[model samples]
Target: MVVFGKELYKIKSDRYKKARGGWSRIIKLHCVECGEYLFDYQKDGAGILKRLYFDRIFKELPKKPLKCKCGQLLGIPIIYKKEERPAIRLFSGVVKK
Candidate 1:
């Protein structure tokens, strides 16, 4: 799927925080056709900052029945990955624990 302007902005902001030694917050979605995973970032605050930004675009997404490769409605899993680590260990370990 092609990402639009607003989606790109969200990704850039998430990357900037990671560059500044902040935790990376990932939001994962799945493709109904191929069972492929699409990973995005959660836009909430880093740790407890008193207030939080909880208005995520995904929250507005409508949950229509997902179609499988065989054209059947099947439920899929949405994973969230959020954590911090060294460069090599970033993708190595669990993002959420």
Candidate 2:
């Protein structure tokens, strides 16, 4: 299936499985600069996407400093202190949901 102008790949996510009690949605992530498909992500809750946890990612990505094929620096990997987990801190306005 295709969604958001990209092919969709449905994958099960265990991130926050217990905490959210299955309250999550899979979203198609794209690069704002070139409109390139980044990856399919499992997102929780509702609001602007601040960051992406490593475990919630459906596709494997390069280590740290995530970038799109168009050369846009999308995000940088960091340890989310509040959640005490590994995550990618997204650059504001660099990505499209």
Winner by lDDT: 2
Query: Over the stretch 1-97, how does candidate 2's per-residue lDDT look in tens digits?
Result: 2243345655454656546566677787899999997888878766789889888788787667998888889889988997798999999999887
- TM-score on alpha carbons, each prediction: 0.23, 0.79
Global CA lDDT computed for model 2: 0.79
Q: Write the per-residue lDDT of candidate 1 for residues 16-94, one digit (tens) a residue.
A: 4665466444454444455554334353435522111223323332333333345544332232234332111122112
Best by TM-score: 2
Model 1: colliding residue pairs: none
lDDT for 92 (candidate 1): 18
Which runs in model 2 stand beyond 4 Å of their true positions? 1-22
Cα TM-score of candidate 1: 0.23
